[model samples]
Target: MNLFQDIRALVIGALEIMQADGVIPVGLDFANVTVEPPRDPAHGDMATNAAMVLAKPAKMKPRDIAEALAGHLAADYRVDTAEVAGPGFLNLRLSPALWQGLVKSVLSSGEGFGRSTLGAGQRVNVEFVSANPTGPLHVGHTRGAVFGDALASLLDHAGYDVTREYYINDGGAQVDVLARSVYLRYLEAHGQEVAFEDGTYPGEYLIEVGEALRRKVGDAYVGKPEDVWLEPIRDFATDAMMGLIRADLKSLGVEMDVFFSEKSLYGTGLIEQALDALDAKGLLYEGVLEPPKGKMPDDWEPREQTLFKSTEHGDDVDRPVKKSDGGWTYFAPDIAYHYDKVSRGFDALIDVFGADHGGYVKRMKAAVSALSDGRVPLDVKLCQLVKLWKNGEPFKMSKRAGNFVTLRDVVELVGADVTRFVMLTRKNDAPLDFDFDKVLEQSRDNPVFYVQYAHARVCSVQRKAQEAGIVVDDAMLAAADLTKLDHEAEIAVAKKIAEWPRLVEIAARTHEPHRVAFYLFELASDLHGLWNKGHDDPSLRFLQEDDVDTSQAKIALARAVAVVISAGLGILGVTPADEMR
Candidate 1:
């Protein structure tokens, strides 16, 4: 059970009782009332704004409302003290039994302790890392990959049916460039000297694709014209590049459920069908867009184009869907793809894009809004650039990946677990610095190591308890005499554990996986703080040499911390370290 939700319900019940009687006026809305942890710990365990938010409608002084609410809430056995603070706040300190009982709840529930039902079975689609199959994935795509995968996992944890997806941009002219690049390599494989022009992809990763083509066709199209060899080699090279991309994602532990191709929308009339839907809604038009704000209308020549009236759905201007040449713009296939997702009956849609795509956000949202008839909600998360560092200097580029840092380069330098965890230390929209030296360092300054060290510390304590011939199993720990855990410092750590469920719901609702990382760091800090206290004061140690019940109670608390840490790490797709070297 969620303690925060339980306390909120109790507060709402008190407000309802006050409304029914003459204490407060009838028909006053209490929807705005909230129960959250006090900002300052000295105030109380939990605070409520019921009195202040309802005072205007109830026509009573804030203190009067607070006084009445406090009296009503203090009657509950869980409320050890309820004090009326400034203006209209009601702060309540819960009995120590509740905090101590949280340890048992954590042990009993295990990894499922913080799982939430906030989504209520809504089906959502998360599309991310739709990188062009031109080369191996670079660091720019790596941030989006990790963020999308973790967000999808977060949604699953919060009771949503989530579909992880990748949209391959294979229909564009970029894929044509890829085909030509592979063709050059194929010529070289056939013992013909070939030159890579400006438009060709010259990465070494594509050399294998060229050799595979030679092996498959046996120089059948060695000297053929462009038209003869273009189509077949395009398919072959795309397949090969996709294999490399999948392997790159595997190195980072990111797996997607669906890989939708942009090429499928072109010949199948999917794009036309989506445009027809918009046409029926009168959201499509044929016209010339106005010039820039500084230019006069007469200064610009008229160029007729097919456009979508995206301004109806909150975009700043109508977006062009087709040029005057009757060719589809990049926006057309994107609209069709999102329409397909909506047709699949996903209640909501999310797209994770690199920060360079910020300008595309409004137009895409408008397209989805028009296509879905405002029935589905769309959220776009933009991941900013990641600046790599090493030994207090900016990390250099990968020689293998000519222009940028390759995803494989990062995963190989640091393990996959460290790469994934370090990428999520900052919010998706904020710029992140991935320090090669700092992230792997075993110090308090490194968040990845700090959180993992806490989990490892708990394992070490459990091992020590076992060495002393103490059985520290979850079943026995759950039933331990937790009343022995009455110290203020011990109770503080239990309170941090209590915040996990609430934090999960908040992070899931906001679609921010970084909050999970931030919360784990705070939880680890508390666990380590308590462990240090035990060093100076023998009574605070987890293992007591003489008594079994007391030892079980203390060790239960430590084990509970590990349970939450493991679950948090699991959500991030990082393995928990049992021991750090």
Candidate 2:
């Protein structure tokens, strides 16, 4: 099914034969030897650098090794010809039978065709969209949500045991501000006008929470002191905000396997336990931090504080874990959170943070490294900002989200599918422009539309073939006389299908789901190219009126393209279109 992988094995086997024949030295490293598609299709179907890579190590001329390797490779049935190019590169022309066999592989595998076992069932925890439970999720959180969800799905497709988690920022001063904001709305709900000054959330969404609080507790806590109302209201307000966040994520088709509360780390002795784990490693210390790096803060002063030896693990400087008053800093709970992840026996941990949190990466990684004794690896992906556009104009801000574009705004404006797909058009570290006009367009320039249209075209072929009274189910396609598919354009499409499994592993390895979007775009372009070629050549068409076998064979290839497209889209959390609207 993986043609390149199979051919690389063949190349290695041929090299081993060369070693046996004294053409090359014994125990030459074949690890760097690679068989991949030629940079230019004019050369051949595949190219290998085995000759060039082994030349210096074996103390032989590259051409001599390439010529010897080519002879051995050409004797294989799958390799039609192996031509030496330049000094050492070996270009290979695989037989049409290999491409034809890939179509059968596609039909047999269906959506599972491109799934990979590269991860080997390694447990990975993906923490994403951990926005503070203070308000509705904004545009930045939307990008993180889509990126994290798609990443989790991609890792799952690559055979990783992925746990999607959300860390609730409910233990901070921010949630206290939210409680006061809700209390303001509660007073307003009681027919007393209240002014929302600075440091309080003034969004109208909290008005409902206030009204609901009134329904829950009739006329109680209306005139209570801050101490009497602060703690209980903080719990109630955070839960309300979390409910709103859940609804927003639900609108965009995102769900978390775990919603961990930061407050739980406080009272449960978890934070102390996590820091103690680091302390046992001799990573904790009492030290004096230098003044703020660039420009000193107005209140800058030196004070001895409890710090973590983050610099020993890779951070730029030691980080303070406790303030002068012995209160935990923001970094302490984060360390505890990652400690919980590491202790849960996950093979790896991934954090999807906003670009603004770029400074937090090394410290968090240092914490995980120290806590897990370097046994667990942590990867942090920073999701950049998303700028919205509509009709060649900047999209209006949301009053509902207090001047920021909400996740629901983007989903409701276009749709969840378009929203998710467009969000991943760029890498997580790159800024993305989500244009309402451009993304919803049915034109081919829109990648989502083009890929969806390709899937729909294959569906159209199935409908026409069914109405023509020719059986086009997967069983029949898999059993078709695929040797009839010998056209150049037809073979090209099959070759693209062969790269799907490889693409999945590459994307999963890089932790970049944007590669899947790019690959799907390329696959759709190939499928579209073949469909266009059919118009000029009647024999190239997928459906033939008289020949049932020939039509089934060509239609079989088209169906395989749809199958792979659906599989790739599934990894991206996109529902493939059966018929374009």
- Output the TM-score of candidate 1: 0.98
Write down the lDDT of every candidate, Cα atoms only.
Answer: 0.93, 0.93
Q: Each candidate's TM vs. the true structure?
A: 0.98, 0.98
577: Cα error in model 2, Å: 1.0
Candidate 1 per-residue lDDT, tens place, 1-581, comes to 68888999999999889888889988988789899999999999999998899888888898999999999999999899999999989999999999999999999999999998999999999999999999999998999999999899889999999999999999999999999999999998999998888878777777788999999998898889999999999999999999999999998998889999999999999999999999999999999988777757675777899999999999999999999999999999999999999999999999999998999999999999998889999999999999999989999987776678899999999988988898899999999999899888889999999999999999998999999999999999999999999999999999999999998899999999999999999999999999999999989999987998999999999999999999998889889999999
How much lDDT does candidate 1 score?
Answer: 0.93
Model 2 clashing-pair count? 0
* Regions of candidate 1 where Cα sits further than 4 Å from its true position: 293-300
Q: List the residue pairs that clash in candidate 2.
A: none
Name the runs in model 2 displaced over 4 angstroms.
Answer: none
Candidate 2 residues 1-581, lDDT tens each?
A: 68888999999999999999999999899999998889999999999999999999999999999999999999999999999999999999999999999999999988988887889999999999999999999989999999999999999999999999999999999998999998988888889889988779888789999998888876687989989888988899999999999999999999899999999999899999998988898888898998877987898889999999999999999999999898999999999989999989999999999999999999999999899889999999999989889889999888876768888888888889999999999999999998899998898899999999999999999999999999999999999999999999999999888888888888999999999999999999999988888788899999987999999999999999999999988888899999986
